[model samples]
Target: MDNASLKKRDLAVLWHPCSQMKDYERYPMTPIKRGEGVYLEDFDGNRYIDAVSSWWVNLFGHSNPIIANAMKEQVDKLEHVIFAGFTHEPAIDLAEQLVAMTPEGLDRVFYGENGSSAVEIALKMSLHYWQLAGKPEKTQFIALESGYHGETTGALAVSDLGLYKAPYKPLMFDVMTAPSPDCFYREEGESWHDYSLRQFEKMRELVEREHKKVAAIIVEPLVQCASGMRMYHPVYLSELRKLCDEFDVHLIADEIAVGFGRTGTLFACEQADISPDFMCVSKGLTAGFLPLSAMLTRESIFQAFYDDYEKLTAFLHSHSYTGYATGCAVAKATLDIFQSQPVIENNKVLAQHMAQATAHFADHPNIAEVRQTGMILAAEMVQDKKSRTPYNWKERRGMRVYEHALSQGALLRPLGNIVYFMPPYVITPEEIDKLADIAWQGIQLATKD
Candidate 1:
């Protein structure tokens, strides 16, 4: 019932994701009892703002009444059924909406339980499509350096982040890596557009050489979230799309983190005026209400798998909870909220407030860069600002900031040395100021010797 008791029980039985279990001995887990509109209440009745949107999944807010009511109504009627042949109205309706909302040419929808599974489904589908088209040699994939797709074997194989994929390298299939278009790596006095265009040469060279063996190229669209919130220009996507078309390679846009108006646009690919072959979406699909993910693809790719069972060309990938009625209903409600309210327009104002609130960090001596991409903003902490020398990862500087922010009643989880804020759409401008103030204090505490 209380924080201490719950911590003891949880530590005894639970293994948390992306955490070193022994660290819990020093920093106890936060026992959240309930959440409401950008705030999570702990068992002790202390409230902390959900600055990261509960791992960037939440959209409208935590415990949103609209989504909750839809879930309740759907569960009352029908909770779930096997998705093999028994289809329901909610599932069918949600799929239709997703196909319509996404960019043109994405006419088919495939269901999965999570983002990683969605990426795996796309990867398998691309390879299988090539096999059925008499090009079995097109078996390889290309990913951006430091890009993260997911943790599954197929997803990890396409990802280039060593932190998650190093230990499992032997288990993963080989993948080619292209230099990231992250603007952080751009030279002095260079524009993001120019640098991104320059970076595309590496990808062009790689794809041109290996197009015959490459099945697809997977990217995280505008912002590479898992890679410390590193971002790039929209022009990169436009050029990448052209290159893929020239080389007959499929472009898979992993919009799991940057989709659903997080990148200022409904979809990041829209800013580039391009449509990817496979669009993997999740996280905010159900507004953090349930586990649901979808892979939207073009009709051309879908047709490659539409063959007789005797030919063994049918795609057999599936999840037991694929297209759950409750999840589908919640997703429909989430979309309804988008339609009813000016979510994207409101976010534009909120994003301006965020930019103004954190602008002071740009002058801080220990802060290298203060970057903003729509609702997501990050301030990279460095040991020296001029040289941009990063603090040793072993020092755990980001953890110090996290602990400080927790004491100040805010949940500003840093991605390594990069402190960031990705608040829900329901957050007000005043709330943005509060989080900015807390983050500033945390940064000072973490930077002090």
Candidate 2:
């Protein structure tokens, strides 16, 4: 079929995720035929650099041979099984490896098919643990402002972006929200350490006052990707952990987007010198080879659910595709790739260069801020840089830059007014320069208004 026919067919048959269907008419979908490391090829043979790593999933790069082979081999053996009773070797190996590689104290892993479901498991586990321990009143959860966990009901309840959750206000659960550690546009001369302290102090007060009713406090450690690539210092995490301990609140680190060496560490919590009571990790878990997410918790949390079966106090949550054989095998192989390859170390050099180059836009009048945490970088555009006032959402300024970059052979989709890059770990120093160049040009082209 021709491109027009394909586009028409897509509009008729396919429903894209997190999108308004009407916009499909204006911006027809570009059908990607295949992907290689850091690049995607459309059906028309047009190549676009995958700067966002396909919504922050493709960490080791798209179509990596090792992960592909693992999935292929596993599919031939056992495609899937009833995870409730039967388990596979790939599942066992992946869980063991994840426990080893994850943050300290995260000994057990509960699997899910996506990040949202993984977060759902963490939330449910936290509530159930408290309930079984005779503190059923501790059902409330605290989340940060502008935090983006996932799209599911429980995940949406904690997320603060009103645009996504506003309409569903009736369906959302009660969640005490705290202000984010917004370091970029802080009061003049505010140090990162000091700024982190202020944000942590707010969280501490919230936990202290609400700890009796609160089950856990969730955070997107180091970097909050969905809400405009907001980042804070590791010191904030150190202080928050102490407060959680003092108030006896479980610290749930939502590292789904930033885990697997995104922030210069295997897990983002490593930089903070703190271990979460439970950690939700997914995006880079399988190096983007397959859909897999895991919510890991400490032995203490696991014990709470280890009571008699008659009580039904067990954390009895299950997903149909829980521990899917192919995903598990691919995840295991992906971990192997991390060990044998210097992916994390390579990102260290690229992150440094990215931070340096992005600094050039810091003072640009239309540029509000530049945030760099590990290899994840974001450039915030503003109508008034000195005032840190972003352009209105109605302007579609970010979406324009997104489309413009696509036309320029780069896939630099903007998150609202923030243009960010979460390129795969396999991207090289030279590719980093190209990413920066294309992003800068998108900035220049986008600000003509």
Candidate 3:
């Protein structure tokens, strides 16, 4: 009934994701009773501001009424049906809206249950398309350094992060690495645009040399979320698009974390005015109300597998819960909210507030950089700010900030030494100030060695 009792029961049998189970012995989990607009409350009535949007999924807020009502109504009628032969209204409507909403040429949608599944679908689809076209040797994929796509075997094969992929090396296929256009490594006085352009030269060279065997180049677009919120200029995407076009390679934009107005636009790719061959979207697709994902691609790619079933060219991938009626209903409502409201314009104001609230961190002695992209803001803690030296991973400096934030009734989960804020769209400017103050105090405590 209470937080302590529930957490004790949980630790006895349940294991959490992205966690070391033994750590729970020291820092017990807080069992949440309910969640509302930008706030989560435990059984003891203690509330913590949902600063991370519950792992960057919830768009409008927790337990949003519009999405909730849509799900309820759809479940009462038809919860789910086999997506292979039978179709439902919710799935059809959501697919149509997604096609119309995404970039210009992405005319088809493939359903998946989560972000990682979407990545797997895109990777498989790309390879299969090339093979169907008689290019079986085009099997390799190029991914940016420090990129994190998903943990599935196929998705992990394309991801470059060592922390997640190191242990599973035997299971992963070889993938080519390209230098990321992260602006954090920009030289002194170099603009993000100039540094990003300079970094793209390496990618250009890699693509030029490897395009013959490379099936596709998968990128996180403007910001690499799991890689310490490292960001770069839009020019990188524009240049990458040009290179992919010239080389006859597919470009997969993994927009799982940065989609739905989180990056100052409806989609991050729009900033570069380019349409990728495949675009994977999830997280905000159902507004955190249900699990769903859609991978949108062009009609030409869809036509590749349009042959008779005896030829074996048809793509046979599927999830048991594909095109789930309830999930599709929630996603439709989420898009409806986006269309009916001034979400983008209002987010601009909140983003400005976030920038102003965290600006002073640029002067902190132990903080290396305070970067932002739309509603996402991050402050990187360093052992030596002058040289931009990072704290060793064993030090766990970010855990100190996380602990302090919990004590102050706020959720400020850090990605190693990088503390970030990604609150829901329903959060207010006043709440942003409060969350910023909490993060600043936590940073001070964490950095005080």
Q: Model 1 scores what on Cα lDDT?
A: 0.94
lDDT of 3 by residue, 1-449 (tens): 99889988998899799999999887778899999999999999999999999989999998999988998898889999999999999999999999998989999999999999999999999999999999998999999998989889988888888888899999988999999999999999999999999999999999899999999999998999998999999999999999999999999999999999999999999999999999999999998998899999999999999998899999999999999889999999999999999999999999999999888988999999999999889999999998998999898999898999999899998999999999999999899999989999999999987
lDDT of 1 at 245: 96
The local lDDT score (0 to 100) that residue 430 gets in candidate 3 is: 92
Instruction: TM-score each candidate.
Output: 0.99, 0.97, 0.99
RMSD of 1: 0.8
lDDT of each: 0.94, 0.87, 0.93
Give the per-residue lDDT of model 2 (tens digit) for 84-117: 9798999999999999988778899899999999
Error of 3 at 334 (Å): 0.5
TM-score between candidate 2 and the true structure? 0.97
Query: For residues 301-389, could you state the per-residue lDDT of candidate 1 as single tens digits?
Result: 89988877898878999999998889999999998888899999999999999999999999999999998899999999999888999
Candidate 3: RMSD over Cα atoms?
A: 0.7
Model 2: lDDT of residue 237: 91
